[model samples]
Target: MTDEQPDRKESGFKETTRVRTARERLRETVAGHDRTERVPLDAADGRVLAEAVVAERNVPHYPRAAMDGFAVRAEDTFGASDRSPEILRSAGEAASVEPGAAVQVHTGSELPEGADAVVMIEHADERGGDLEVFDAVGAGENVAPVGEDVESGQRLYDAGHRLRPSDLGLLKSVGVREVEAYEPPSVAVIPTGEELVAEDPAPGEVVETNGLTVSRYVERWGGAATYRDVVTDDPDALREAVERDSDHDVVVTTGGSSVGERDLLPEVVSELGEVVVHGVALKPGHPVALGVVEETPVVMLPGYPVASIVNAVQFLRPATKWAGNLPVPDPPTTDARLDRKIRSEPGVRTFARVSLTDEDGERVATPTRASGSGILSSVALADGWVVVPEASEGIPADEVVAVQDWEALP
Candidate 1:
């Protein structure tokens, strides 16, 4: 474990704090400690599996017909076609099963005990008890053999796989009524600071929107947002909230993370639990904090709306996925030419909101004005954000940058 001691002189900010690289800080924040639960297949949508799901039996269960036609030995219809037809009488030699077969089978019906192929209805003609066969089919031409779709004892899905609609259908087809899935990690979000309030506040009071946004993200990531409330910038109150909400797997507190007299979140977190990480080397979200309270992971984020959200993407999102036993997917990215130059401080990763538009049949990005930490509206208005690496001072116009997707493309 790397040290998170304060390194105030690195950035020349009035308040100096130790900061870890984005990846290092994220690694220090551990996943929630929780067990698995069994959920019905229908309710397991979007949930991650805790165990492998194996097929109990083969798909289709038996060899079946694949078309409405006569089931017969492929050799019997040899040289059969429009110009060269084979006439076979339905006498004692070939019993009259249906209009033209020893026995006619509809599509999907089980093939007769000895049949190896099906002669489609279009390939046969009935003429007063005498059948003319044409368009000969080879063996296994129209037969769906047992285990053709899936084999018995096959591992249909492995642990840590997120269930999709198609996966549900496959599970249903394989007769899986319930599955072992990781229990949804319970999360408690506490929005702190005297300037914050749950309800509409007087002028200058910022409404508590971070908790709502965090809650939605938690739910979307397959974790349950069990509690959301506001707390004043008091270490005692914050400690009380942590102790009371220790039942949850993770607790999040927004605001009061900076090293100011009013910023007592760090102190409260340390008093109640162990502070693992204090800050991150990322623009708009440098004050992000990580700790553990009573064995439950606790994350403290900056008060600014954009900062909170960006930190959520960088930290909370992955933590939720890990808690749910889900295999994390690479963050969505797209390549587009930069429309203008954007500067950034060295040694800090920057996420800039950008609007993607089609200019003369090419996709171009327009950086939004709400690139600041306080602007939440830009997140909704922009298509996605562009990630600027710490190694580069800035990105020049016409340079191809990978833009993260925020909404469905137009």
Candidate 2:
């Protein structure tokens, strides 16, 4: 761990930082910080609200027909049926209905003035513009009243709310062309390591892929990602790349935060700004690093693919989302019985990937490979992660484990 000898040949690695503290600091660093933009309706999907979206006008602003039929007076239609039908003159489309008269109206068409009810087309017969009503309808039946969906001056969404597709429809219904929302964070993913190759790595070299993977993760987390070239394991080179990427909202570096000989992210982050954490108390992700450089949040992920993915899910994803005031992408959770024993080191929070299946009317979880973090297939073949609390040593077979990141409950 000395400056002269950057590559320390040490066993077990010297890790001093805790995971929870690092996450707490990251939260503090990113909370309530983002720029607002008045984005057009077309580009506002998945963006968080920076201001309340008040209804400019009532949804359906006018009384509209809810069915294709005749708009009539409910009292007039009473006592009218197939056997003893009520006869009335039709006023035609958009025409006002006189007493004992009906107006032709289509679904979603505005109800003619003085019309209080609409009899569906199936319940009424239109013969040469003349109307014969068979079924009676109550006042306001099959009619969308004024402000039926949203009232004018009502706030449809509060600040910090994320916009969905349906939310855009709501705004469009109220004639909102654009909305003020938090801009998505711009992230830079920089992969660092001397042994890393751009592509087609031989036996002695490893392919650099964490940046691409992290860039995609950042994009999925509602951020614009710029994947930077893989910087060699040099403090100056890493520091320069980080400085240049500081224009972005956040920077995520991979493959040099651990206590290994070539791990250099912690030192570079410290020299550039401040290293909030250099290690974590989580298994596989224990080498995750968190920091802030030039007020830009920097997340140094472990070199291992699984570790990088897990830590990205744990830290970077939320940071990117929160920087833009976006909501967290909360995965569905489910509980299942362990199909076999899952072991973990006590005092280290573990995330064991497991594939679950319904066997004998019960959900059974089989553990994935519990080897080194470089094993990507271990997690890819699995459905969800089973959390092993720091206080617990191991979970025995048949024990019900909550799959916190599960897509759905079995």
Candidate 3:
């Protein structure tokens, strides 16, 4: 523990800790435990490849025609032109086509025996039983040489590579019917609160949504999520839920990390496992917790949407990415000027929702009315946001910032 404690007079949480230090611990906990699986090519999308796929054969294994033309030796068309055309007899089979004769061929068709070039169909005129070439072509012209696209035993993809839709087509073209990839990490989220309800809520009960938020974020990082029922602010119930979900790669419990009498997540985590971090120095997310149970990492997020989403974006998503060896997705962003000034407490990171406007071809960002962490619509209505770091004050009006988008660009 620490000699200095957080000043919780203004905040509601009992514990306080640094955000970066806690995140480093979580990263160490999630590394080096990824699992692998073999799946058909159809199921490889969005999966991290565990093995490299190599080409089995040459693409266009033979010397094939690259256009609809008459196949002939380069010497036959060396000086042929519109002014002085070379008339060659059209022969039937390879055995019948002697020197100075052209063989009929189409796109992708194999070149006839002893033919080293092709005269495009448009450049050749059919005259009775012969083809009159009006344009000269050099050796190997208009022909697809062997291994032109891909060579045999060429490495197509390397391990730790994430598969995309276009990657599937390339894998098929390389003659790979299946692939070995990391299995998606499995996460179990258990929401705990006495005043939370599932489907129908009483007059004072709140509908549980943090579990859904955590689960959805987990899935985005190539992880499978299972949300358990709310544990009702009981230590025993929370412990049971955590123990039951130990088989999963990560166990998450939302709510009940405060000093309130009903809050039992911290106590349950301490009793059933080990609580490494009780609170993070993040605004609207100070009560966050991190622990381990039955060799499984457990993350405790605040019940509020703002805290849950930010923590998920900062913590759970990254952990899942490491577990699956996934490539970090790039979020599209735009540079904008702040519409107004915003302030923050020292040594604490804060996130705010902002709506954007185009002011004379320049984007301006204004803070949204939804400042409370529990206001889901605030974030939904926002175009994007600007995050203030822990060591700084707030941004001044007109200060340009990068607003990260919810989706990445193609």
Candidate 4:
């Protein structure tokens, strides 16, 4: 772990910290920050509200016909029946209805000025320049009153509420064109490795996909992501990349986080700023690191695809939520009995990929066959992951576990 000799086997970490400790440090570092911007209602879907939204005007501000019928005074149609009808003069398309007069109106049309109710077209008939009413009408029946849907000055949404598609429609109905919402956290995703290539890779080279995957997840989690190209395993290059993206709310780097000689992010992060938690006791992604540079959080992830994804969900997801003044909720989970025993270390937290199937009218979770840090298909094809806590060794067969859908957006 000395400066002159780079550690090859153990990656300089004498003892890895627990997963809970690492998450607490990261949450504490990036909490209590606010950034807001005005967003149009059309683009406000999934954005968090910066302030409470109050309606400026009522929905359906004027009384209108709720059904296709004739507008008439309620008293004029009193005691009307199918056998003996009340006859009134027909006032075609009248702006106002007088006594013993009926106005022709359609659904959603404004009620006439003097009209207090509407007699359904089926209950009334126009015959020989007169209207025959066969049913009695209440004073306000079949009319959409003012503020029927939403009252004026009503609180639509409070701060930190995430806007959905239906929410935009309600806002538009209340005459709100835009809203003041917290801006999505900006993220700079850097993929670093000497053997990574953009497209066609040679024998030893690998295609760079971690940056793309992580960047898309950032957007899904309500953040803006800037995916960067691959940087070689050089201290100067890696340091410059980290400094270039220090202005972003979060800097996530995939690869170059292990204890091998090529892993140089830990050293560079320590030199520029403080490393909050370097190595965590988490299976398949324990090499992940958390640091802060110029007050912006930097997350160092393992090069393996599965490991990178695992750490991103555990660390980067919550980091963005805290920075944007949004709610950090848990992912959706389902309880299922284990089909077979799953092994894990006693003190390290493990995320075992499992695919669910119904057997004997019960949901059973079976661990994926290729359960390795480098295996990507193992997770892509699985339904969810079962988390083994740091307390116990592993879950025995027939034990129920919560299968967390890790990719579920918050």
Candidate 2, 268-354: lDDT as tens digits: 777788877667888877888788988899999998999998899888988888787777756777789998898988778888999
Best by lDDT, which number? Answer: 4
Model 2 spans > 4 angstroms off: 1-18, 78-94, 121-136, 360-362, 406-410
Cα-lDDT of candidate 3: 0.80
| Model 1 misplaced stretches (Cα beyond 4 Å) | 1-22, 25-34, 88-107, 121-131, 406-410
Model 4 RMSD in angstroms: 3.5
TM-score of each: 0.88, 0.88, 0.86, 0.87
Between 3 and 4, whose lDDT is larger? 4
Better of 1 and 3 by lDDT: 3
lDDT of candidate 2 vs native? 0.83
Q: How much does candidate 1 score in TM-score?
A: 0.88
lDDT by residue (43-68, candidate 4, tens digit) is 99999999999998987999999989
Could you tell me the lDDT of residue 41 within candidate 3? 87
Off by over 4 Å in 3: 1-18, 68-70, 81-98, 101-109, 120-135, 356-364, 407-410
Clashing pairs in 1: 6-18, 7-18, 8-16, 97-102
Question: How many clashes in each structure?
Answer: 4, 0, 0, 1
Compared with the true structure, what per-residue lDDT tens digits does model 1 show for residues 85-174? 877543322322333343466788877776788778788877776668878878898889998898888899888888998999898887
- Model 3 lDDT tens row, 1-410: 23443323334554567777988888767764557889898988888889888987888788899999788888888788889999898874453246889988889988887888888999999889888999999999998998898898999889988899998987787788889998888889888888888778779989988888678777777888997888887777787888899888888878886666776776677778777777788876787878877777888888887777777776777777776677767667889999888777878887767888998998998988769888888876888767788888888888998887753311
Residue 126 CA displacement from its true place in model 2, Å: 6.6
Q: What are the per-model C-alpha RMSD values against the true structure? A: 3.9, 3.6, 3.4, 3.5
Q: Which lDDT value does model 3 have at 321? A: 79
